[model samples]
Target: MSEQDNATLIEVKGLYKLFGSEANKHMHLVHEGLSKDEILAKTGHTLGLKDINLKINRGEISVIMGLSGSGKSTLIRHFNRLIDPTEGNILVDGTDVMTLDQNQLEQFRRHKMSMVFQRFGLLPHRTVLDNAAYGLTVQGLSKKEANERAVEWLETVGLGGYEKQYPSQLSGGQQQRVGLARALATNAEILLMDEAFSALDPLIRSEMQDQLIELQEKLHKTIIFITHDLDEALHLGNRIAILKDGELVQDDKPEEILLNPATDYVEAFVRDVNRARALTVETVMQPQICRITADSISDALKQMRKTDDDYGYHVTDDGYQGIVSQETLEEAVRDDNGDDALCEKVYEDIPIVAPDAVLEDILPETINADYPVPVVDEEGEIQGELSREAIADVLSPDQVPEEAAKASQPTAT
Candidate 1:
């Protein structure tokens, strides 16, 4: 992509959608500050969306969330021109979608975008291979080329050997995988998923969410996901746009929406979800932390003593390897080993997690660990560490540990 395309792939500007012919005739009533109900009563047009504006950045998951009538699904349809906006325009890579003629729009939908629907949208009689290859075949690829790409994507989505099975033969989750593979096989830059995982069972839905995140790490397609579930939105979205009664109420990163809700309605939604599910280790990890190598036990002990600390994280050019503690230092001295170099080999690959592993994803990993859990990035770089004490401080500001609070105060700005 060019620099401009990288910034904002899709931009929605002052969009409005009303479900009635001659909707423009009712624009004056909308400008009169009428509510959705009032506008409907007066103009006989249902207000699907009102003045919605959002910018979807390249290679990021942008989730639009709302209840049934809040216009979440309605807004997503405008991106592919599946349903044109009643007023205003949408821009894709700075090209106004409204300016595209029938052929241009057809090409745009065929090559530039692919959509996954709530109902799976698979042909009942077609085999999984045929369904997955349908998008590429529609673009006029040869049977052999389309099937090869379809086979690759079906395996990518964990449906490797199920190529000959029909959609009805698969479970709801497996069928959804077929839907996802079909969408992915097209290899469109922008992926529109309208409640793609909503119909699955709860456990299956969670699995699908994890699969999407894992796939996104490698592919990084510009994804616009629609969900009414707040937890799903928080787990998947890089930035969330929340709608209430067809108007965008708040647009923010997951943490911002949790820590500072823009309105009472947003606050109400946040209150229901336990914040731990929405927050990851990256949000509250302590970045400016003690870094000690495995061979520096004596030096590390001195540094920890000066700071009145018991633990230190070990990192190298290869990035965060593991952690060390005072107990390990004591063991080192008791062994009477002058060389701490070989001690590194003893416990180089230790993975520890905690008790409430299912109830809450992050907190237990911090609380149950012998020391603070190190926060590693996608590339295995050490960004910071997350601890029970810090989580406590965040949850109960009035009872902050003085040392932890003091250490983080500098970066509060």
Candidate 2:
């Protein structure tokens, strides 16, 4: 795909929505700082969204989260023009959705986007295969072609061999799989899931979330997921948009929301969040580090003696070489028989982590580990190092976790 298509698939500018006959006329009250209740009492209009400016990037899950009546559901419907905005522009792939006529809108929904409903929305009389092929059939594919495409997606969603079963015969999770298969069968560029797993059992919901994540890795479809649950949003969203009383309160990554909530309401939502699962190794790693390019064991030992720390990273201009402890170099200087390779690397087996690895995933590696963890990028180059002390600080009850927005970026000395 072109870079432009992958940047921002949807962009909402100056968006506002209110439920009343004269909703557009009452928008000035919202801009004047009138609360939702006040507007309802004075203008007889219930505000759904007000001045919501957001960008939903391609190939990422952008979650819209809010409590009941917070307009999250209303906002999502506006994407496909199911509910028109009272005021503002909704741009999808650089085309204003409001400008599309009925025929154009129908074609847009069929080709550009597909939705998975929360209630599974499966036709009861149809078999699983027919239900899964619903979208393809709607798009005018023949039964033979639609069924073949649906079968592949059904298998992909782990519902293989159940094509003949009716919706009533399958479990809730299985029925949801049918819904997901139907959405994926169309091969649309965008997937809209509005609280898709909220009705299932807790365990089933968790499993579906995992499956969705796995599917996203392979398909890379732009997804807009709606959920009220903070845990669900944190788990699924690459970027989260939190709403309160129809106004956007916070829009940020999960770690930023946890570390530095934009408002009190957002803070309350993330107050009890487990830091280990939400944060990654990238946030805690110190990238601005000292590296020694020593050519000899005596030279390496002399360089290490100047630093107060016990260890040093041995790296060239290209990338990381290895780590050397002052004690190891001291021993090497005394024991080396004029060997040139002595200054190359002290230990071959050291704990290392990827920048994107969650802290929880790498917690066990740090336990009783004598060495500092090296942070490596995807290009197999070392970017930074992580210390156990840094990990403990965030986990400590007495320690105030560093501001995540600041911590995630490199600090200039």
For each candidate, what TM-score against the reference? 0.80, 0.89
Mark the regions of model 1 whose C-alpha exceeds 4 Å error after superposition.
1-5, 289-365, 368-382, 395-413
lDDT of 1 by residue, 313-407 (tens): 66667766677676676677677652565245433243433222322465444565556776766676777767666676555344344454454
- On the 0 to 100 scale, the lDDT of residue 211 in model 1 is 99
Candidate 2, residues 130-215, lDDT tens digits: the string is 99999999999999999999999999999999999999999999999999999999999999999999999999999999999999
Off by over 4 Å in 2: 1-6, 303-308, 315-321, 336-340, 343-345, 348-350, 377-379, 396-413
